[model samples]
Structures are given as C-alpha cells and as structure tokens.
Target: MSAEHHPRDRRTARVGLVLFLLTAVLYVATAGYQRVHIDVLSADVGAWRIAATGEPSIDGLDTSSINRSRVDLFSTVHDGRTVIARSPGVVAAGVPAYALRQWVTDAGPDAEDFTTVPPTVTAALLTALSVLLMWGALLRLTTRRRATAAALVFALATPVWSVAADGMWTHTLTVLGVSGMAFGAARDRWLLVGLFGGIAVWGRPHMALVAAALALTCAWVRRRPGIVARVAAVGATLTAGASLWSYWLYGRWSPSGGYAPAPYLSRGAGAQYEFNQTLGGLLRNEAAMWLSLDRGILVWTPVVVVLLPLLVQTWRSQPAWTRALFLAGVGYTLFQGAVAPFHGGDGIYGYRHGLEFLACATPALVVATARVGRRTRVVLTVVIGVQLAAFSLGGVLNRPTLSFRHHWNDNAFVSGLRDVPLLWAWVAISVALVLLLSRMFLREGAREA
Candidate 1:
C-alpha cells in the first residue's frame, strides 16, 4: 500500500488498521460463544476430506461412524456419495481451513475428528475481514469519524460477532457479499456490483432478489442500459452455475443447494412452509422484528432503534441507487417475515436477517449520522452501551438451547447479573466501550459545534 502523505488520511489509515486487529482478535476469541449449526460446523472438514482424496463416495469410510453426527454435515447423493449443503460458497470458503486442519491433525474423513468450542479460525477471520470491508465502504461515503464508529458498531454490536463469527454459518458470505455491493456501488464499479450480488445469491438463494434489486436499481437510476446487461449477466451466470451443480448433486436446481427443504421452525403457526402475506400478518412481523424482545433488533442492538430511523429520515437525501438498494433491503426483509418466523432460527443473538438491511442502507446511515442533535448523540451513546453488553454476553453466557429463542431476553440479562464470574467481565467490557465511544463522539461533536 502506498503511503498517505496527508495527515488526516494517514490517521484514518492507522485507525482502520488498529480497528481491524482489535476486531479480528475479538472475533477469534469469542468464536466458541454460540453453538453453531451441526451442518455449518462440520461442512468444512467433510468437504475438504472428500475433495483432497478425490473420493467418489463415502462408501470407503466406516458407515458405523454415521451415528456420531459427522455424517449430518453433508447431503447424500448417488451411490452413497455426498455433497456439502451449500455448494461452492460456504464450502469453498473453508477449503484453506480444511487444508490447515488436515496438516495439523494428519487425519482424513474416516478419522471422525469433529467439534470444537470455536468451530474454525478461518470463519472468524472472514467475519473480521467483512467488518474491515464495511469500514472501508463507509469511508467512501462519509467522514472518517462516523465511518469508524459505524464500522465499530457493525463489528461488535451486531450479529456479525454473535452469529456469523461464532461459526461457519452462511451469514459469513452474506456480510462479505453485501460489503462488496456497498463498495462496488460507492465506487461505480458495475462488474463488482454484479459479482458480489451473485455471491450473495450463492449464500442464500433468497438473496437472488436482493442482488437483482441492487443491480437493476443501480443500472436504472444511472440510466445505463448496458449496466443492466453487464451486471445481470454476471449474477445470472453465477446463479446458473450453482443451480446446475445443485441439480447434479441433489437432483434439484435450488440456489440453497438442496438445503432449502430443511426444517424451518416458524414463530407464527399455520404450517411450517406457510407464507402469511396478509396486511395484518406483515405488519405484525414488522413490529415483531423491530421490537419483540426475543428476536427483535431493539432487544439485541438497541443502538439500531436510534441508528435505523436514519433510513426513513434521510431517505430522500441518499443517492438514487442507494435509496433503491435500501428499499430493496426492506422488501427482502418483509419477504423473510412473511415466509417464516423473524427469529431466523431457534436461538441466536440479535437479528441475523437485519445484517443485510444494514449493509444496504449504510450509505444513507452514514449521511444521517453526519450531523445530529446532542440529545440524539446521548441516546446513541447509551444504546451503544447496551449493544456492547448484549453481544458480549456470548462467551460468558451458557449455550442457548433451541427453545431458548423465546426466553433469550430474560435469560441473557438475568443470568448475566446473577452469575458472579460473568458479571464483572461482561459489565466491565461494556462500560469501558461506552465510555470510550462517548468521549470520542462528544469531543467530535463539540469541535463541530
């Protein structure tokens, strides 16, 4: 990297570097806080072993070992062969880690070595990189001060730490893809916009809508018809390749690579797969998502209740493409609410699905925060304090059960206060962050005034 001669730019660069290292360490250290999905935790090892030895099937391995939960990592295919649930995305990301693990353990698929507190080091690193990329994206649109703070919140106070960094969940790709979109759009790089959109689709087939929404909106807003073809073709090619591979592996063409049919626990009952699109139902899901204590954004990240209102207040002020991207995020979120429960899964920290919306509206958010009243700044500080405590509960807290999704609000606070060991650590960290951030923001606000 070239040296930045300007003092201000150099300072920003130094800050970004320090933040990267700090967040990276945080992610790696806390990775074991949550129990990852059985499939996500094991997919890396399974795929690596299969690809390394060029095995056509698992038939050569001990079938007796299937009882150990190792085999649940993959989907069975023809003639006893198997494929990782999400092809070429999550599986592909873990290839290097798998190689590293193999070198360390000197084991193969039959070894049945599995499970750990923090599933994979690589997963944590990827999530850290995602935060760094977000910081860089924010820098392109807003002042260094706001960008850094917003990125810090993105790294610590959000599900990026509690959920994505905890394991090899597919949300890892979602953050990466969304950050790529933010960066590409900010820089007016059409191919990047397309490539990352396609990558997001690979993470969650449902994200195909998000990718298309972003690409088309950008192209139309810019009045560049060629961009539509260029971006669309890129995303289309990627989605098609994944779909074809899905057909080969699971006799299905779904983007989730045959994992789409997996059991999804619904909060509102009718049927497991039911889509309740009524006005009342949609409104209810919207309210539940924003404020419900169990899985609500407010409960997990109170700062968002303050930060996210920027989406509406500053919508008209955002660039055309960014506004469209923000709206696309809203549409995708509502779609998620209609089709399934907003909890994402049984028990997780914060809102997993809100990750995409934040990524999409980051441009607008940065602008809205550029200038704020002192009262708003005070509220922001307190909420950031709450956010720090909420995500920090992961490592010190007990493993959350599937049913604990509903009980999360109660268990998290009550247990933390009651547990002697956790109380000091959790409260200390949060107090330190809130004080540190408050000083920085208040100092900056005074200078501006």
Candidate 2:
C-alpha cells in the first residue's frame, strides 16, 4: 500500500501547495486592487465601526444599511439601554473586543481610528485557513493527490472564492470554524476539535451543533468505557466554558444568543420545516424567499448544479458514523435557511444562510471532482475556469444586477460580459465542465458496489 501511496501523497501535497499559491495570488490581486480603489478601510466598514464601540450584539445591522448609512459603534440606542451591532457597533467576540478597546484608548472616537487593517487582513487570512482546512480534510478522506486537487477546486470555486475575496460577511469566520472542526475530526484530536467547535459557536450561535456533534463523535470513536468517559468529560468541560462565556455576554448560552428559541425545540422545528415542509405549503414560500435573496446562484447556474452531486456523493459514502457529520453540516445550514428571514431570500449575499453549508460541502467537491477520468477532469477544470472568469468579470465590471437588486448593489463585471459573445463563451465553458464532471459521476458510481 505504501509503495503506491507514497507517490500519490507527494503529488497531492504538490497540488495542495499549488492550490494555496493560486488562492494567494487571487486574494492579493483582488484585495490589493480593491484596497487601492475603494479604501480598504471602507470595504466592510460597518464591522470596524461596530468594533470601535462596545456593542455586544449585531442583530440590528441588516442589509438595509449597506450603502445608505454609516454605523456608529459607540452611539447608544434610545434610553441608552442598548447598542447596535453593525457598521457603528462591534459584536465583542474573541480578539475583536480587546483590539477595539486598545484602539479606543489610543486614538479616541476618530471614526477612522479603529483597527481596520487587522480585520480585513484577518478576513483574508481566514479564507486561506479555510481553504487549507478543506484541503486537509479532503486528504484525510481520500488519496493525497486527489485531496490536493479537491483543495484547488474548492479554493478556486466561483461562489466560495468570490465571497472569500469580497470580505463582506461573517461567513468567512464561520467557514474557518467549520473547516477547523472538520480537520480536527479527521485527525482524531478531540481536544482541538472541541476547541474549534467552541470557536465556531462563538463566531455564530446557530453553529453550536458542530461542537456538540464533535463531542458525540469523540465518545463514539473512543468507545471503551474509560476512554469514552475521559473524552466526554474533556469535551463537555470545554463546551461548557465557551457556552458560559457567550451566555455572560448575551444573558443566553447560545451562538445566536438573542435569537435562539426559548427551549431549542424551535430550532429543530425550523430545520424540519425546511427539510420536510410541503412544496405547496410553508416550505415552498420559504424557498421562494431564499431564492429571491440568493439570486447570485440563480444567475450563476454552474455553481448551483455542483451542489446536488456533492451532497449525493456524501450521502452514498460508507460508514454511518462518518456520514453523520456531513449530514449535520447540511442539516444545520438548511436549518439556518429555514429560520433566517428573507433578508433578500436569507439576506445580503444571495443564500447567505446556506453559506455555512457551502463551506462544509466544498471539500467534498474537490474530492469528488478529482476522482474522475483524465478527459473528464479536463472538462471540469475548463468549466470551473470559465465560472471563475465569469465571476471575476462580474465582480470587476458592471453587470445586470443578478441579486440584491433592492439595494442597487452592482459592481459586477459580467453585466457587459454577458452579451452575445460572452454568452457563447460561457456556454462552451459550461459544456466542457459538465462533460468532465459527468465522467466523475460515472467513475464514482462504478465504484459504488
């Protein structure tokens, strides 16, 4: 086994390094260019505004404030009872608070004096970390070479990478948390896994399930009575400590602190409604709302198509225990979609609620895609290349507003690129990708005995 495995492992490592390098190039190119033109300080300026003030919440800063207003982090709400969490307010989690406090002491309410560089830099760094984690997780699941290819595809994935570069939402942080947990699990480092799980929840309350699921997995994996007991004790203790810290801030021990249901049943109910609700009933309506908000996916159908097969491959994988973690990631993301209001269909960046799942499922794409025949691999690569080119164009130039139109947010480069010539280009690119990816499906199916 090692004889065959050795070469494959080396190749995978090389692929992973290449993928990392490519991602770095894309990120630096985009962020550096963007910073020059748009003032890096002003990109996701709301987050910085929030950090400067002592707001412990972010509930109030919806997409409505996108281009219209500047959020004041230090301003008090009516009656001085509460502070908002948005452009003007900070969520006070982990390092953001300490950083903000120090800045305030050093600079004093200058509005422009907050720690701007670190957050944006951190956002970019998190993207790199997430990609690395995905690569590692995929490596654990498959041959080294295949894992590296998967990481490359994931890093360059149109939707995932595009969002990573924009640095608009908290989804990046959540991605880091989820990816970290996955890495921990694959390595059997329950303690580190538990720590990441805690961080994931800390980053976003709705993600609390990730940590809980890890804890359970730890117990099951180390099932001997003594080892199980020890794992459980350590896992529970870590989780409790993090939960307590959160509760201390929001007076509730939850990720979505204020929004979490009274008893937690509602959270489960929301997930069920999303998964099982009838097409003609509440579920359909919910889906429609999500679609409206996530128009980006609608506009970019290629990325959308990849999601189904990605899920299918995971569903068919062996070992019920292994599959449960993947399912939990899906369930939690779908739950977010069900419960979250249609901030445009779930909020700001199309399908924002499901971004969490996208992050978790992304590694699977690389693994599944790489396992295809050579010609098929070429086709898939072409398609992904086209998608990236299309997305980059859309991002860099004017494009017909595909999503978030209510906000008049249109900086997309594809607006002009979507003309007849570009349309044909997109079509050719897509056909090639589909052909390759289809071969991948056939190969995986053939092996499914």
Candidate 3:
C-alpha cells in the first residue's frame, strides 16, 4: 500500500495482464487459422449445436450413431437438428442454462453455422476468466506478485494451452468452476464457491470428485462449523445443478449413473468383473501406456526437478486445504483411470485423458519451480525445456492430430508429406529456443525466491 510498493504492484499487474492476453491471442489465432472441422471433440459439440437449432450442418454431414437405441434417443430429442436430450437439459436448468441462453440471444455471426458462434471466442473468454480467478485464489494463498506469476505460468502451461485453442469443452468450463471454488474458499465466500462448484458439475459430472475431496478435507481439518457448513453447501449446490441435467437426460433419479450399470459393465462376461477389479483393470488395460507417457513429461520429470522440494521449503508452503484439494485431484484421476473402459480405442493422444491429472498437478508444479535454488532450478528447467521442445516440434512436424489411434510408434507425424529438410531444421531451432528461454526463466525465479 506504500509508495515504494506501488511500482512493484503495477509491474505485477502488467505481467498478469500480459499472460492473460497471450492466452487470448493464441486461441484467436488458432480459431481464425483454420475452418471449423468435425475432427476435434468440441467440433462435434458445434455440429450438434447447429443440428439442434434447425441450421444446416457446417459440412452437411450427419453423424452416425451405431446402435438403434441411441439413434432413437437422438432422433426423438434432436428433431430440430440440435441435441434435445442432454445438452438441452443443461441449458434448461442450472448455471449452464444461464450461460448458454445468454450466448444464444447475443447478436453475432453463427461462426460455426450453429446457434453459438465458434467456440473459440466463447471459450477464450471463459478460459481468460478462469485464469484470472486462479490468480485471485493464488493471491489469497501467497504474495500477490508471486501468485500472479504462478497463475500466469499456469495459464500458459500445456494442458491449458491445448484446451483453450481447441475451443470449448467441459475442461474449460471446469477450469472456471474450480477456480471459482478456490477463490471463494480463500475469501470465505461459501455461497459463491457453491455456485461455481455447481456450474462445474453441470459442465462435467466428474468434478463431483473434486467437490467431495474438498468437503472431506474440510471435515478432516476441523474447520469452523460455519466454514464446514459452507463447504457442504457448495457440494449440495453442485449436485443439485448436475441432477437437473442428469434427470432430464436419463429420465431416472440418479444422473450420476452410480445406480445404473456402466456400459462397460454389461459388454461381456467380464463386464461384471471389471467394476470390481478396478486397479487390475487399469493395469491390464491402461496403465502401461499411461505410466510410460506420465514418465515422458508433466509428471515424473517435473517432480524430479527442484520444484516439488522447493515448494516444501517455501516459507508459504501450501495449507491443508490446498494439499487436500490436490490429493482429491489425484484420487479422482486414479478412480477414473481404474474404471474407464480402456480397450485401446480411438481417443488416446499420448493418453489425452491424463490431461485432467495434469491440470491438478500444474499449480503444484509451478509452486515447486518457484521454490528451488538457482543452480538446481536451471538444471530442472533444462529438463523441462527438452521435453517441451520435443512435444512442440513433434506437434508441428507431424502435424500430429491428438487422438488415441496414433501412438508413439505410429510414425503418423507427417507420414504422408514430402520430407523438407529446411523446414524441419527451422522448427527444431524454434522449439529449442523456447525451451531454452523457459529454462532461463526458471533459473531466475529460483534465485528470486
């Protein structure tokens, strides 16, 4: 609040704003760079949006549902070329209804030929708000300037980078919900926290795991009666929000699907066995690939770097709620990993499902990076630099599509393209420079800490 601190505060604000802008620009560039295509997940949502609203398809292609039941469900509900069953349910109830309705009434070009403009604009706005909320939460947990930098780094991190540019998805929405809850807890705004958590569940039911974890952590910590009551209020609110959609889509009392058998649970004789054999199923079906990729980046390597240890050593080490929230994140991923039907199918880009795990780990990773000694931090940064360089270069050269059909050994990277030595070299150099700068930044952060 003093004059001496004014310049420092201004600088911090500028840095945070710059990071936010960078994220926004990146999404805009990608959205405008290519026409919307059905190859991506969010694009499918766009297609449904168009169909539901009585608009012609962007590419005039109708999607196929393999089973008769699904087709009937879709047809009965999707009469207007839009999805009538589930999505409409969300729009009709809870927070999403508010956001979606607001989106539809706003005058704008139908960028994707559906009711909503291209997800890029809408999602970018959402992602920016999410990141800003994260900054606020971090500020509550630490110094304003340090929290700003940490949050900025988190916004630019790979998990977020992929989601924001790829357009709207449940993850972007979840990010906002999670950040809101985090900020609300920091400020003791229980009801506001409940609202965000509720919205998150409306977006993705899986977030119930996060809410449960927060509640349990609150209880375990012996929080004040009022605070504990408030946390429970958040969980109840989220459950109520999600229930509105689930009941409409499922026509059942339980939308969380706990009462119903999992689709995988009925697929074969093993179906019944699968649910009970959680860890065993994951080991046999998903773990080998999951662990291998986890080792590659975003998990093992970052932990080995000075960051985790540095985070422990920091004067402002994470509190009980923060640690519990992280544990819940881990538990959620593990629970899903154990139960998800993993038959080595089409949706597995370097294990795309793991992105959820990465999101939870990101804040910890940044905090850890901020806590290390300069020399050790430089070493760790170099390691991250190498990995990111590999990832980005591999991305560009291969024009790699993010999906499970293409695995590490698949040589899908530019498999059909003519080899160009000059272009290849240029991309490599660019990747290297980015990594190098990242390393330097980490080293500088270590010294400053």
Per-residue CA lDDT of model 1 for 1-449, tens digit only, reads 35555776677778878988988888887775234555564555445654456442444555344334433555566545665455546665666666566677775566465334323577788778788878887877776777777888788766778777877677878777888777777777878878888888777777777777877777777788777787788888988877875776567777667575444434345446443535676677677766666566667666656767665677677776667677877787777676666666554655677777766666666677755667887777777776667666653242443344454345444444565566666666786778786686646644421
lDDT of each prediction vs. the true structure?
0.67, 0.50, 0.50
**Each prediction's TM-score versus the true structure:** 0.83, 0.66, 0.70
Highest-scoring model, TM-score = 1
**lDDT tens string, model 3, 107-225?**
32243333324444666666777787778777766555557556655554344544433445455566777777777766767677667766666655677677667666665675555
Mind sharing the TM-score for model 3? 0.70
Alpha-carbon shift of residue 220 in model 2 (angstroms): 4.7
Among all windows of ten consecutive residues in candidate 3, which has the lowest summed lDDT? 66-75
Per-candidate Cα RMSD to the true structure, in Å, reads 4.3, 7.5, 6.3
Q: Alpha carbon lDDT of residue 437, candidate 1?
A: 62
Model 2, runs deviating above 4 Å: 1-25, 28-81, 86-106, 114-116, 214-254, 257-281, 285-322, 342-350, 363-379, 394-449
Runs in model 3 lying further than 4 Å from the true structure: 1-11, 32-117, 140-149, 186-188, 253-261, 264-279, 285-289, 294-317, 341-351, 387-398, 402-449
Ranking by TM-score: 1, 3, 2
Give the CA lDDT, 0 to 100, for residue 142 in model 1. Answer: 74
State in Å the error of residue 20, model 2.
Answer: 4.1
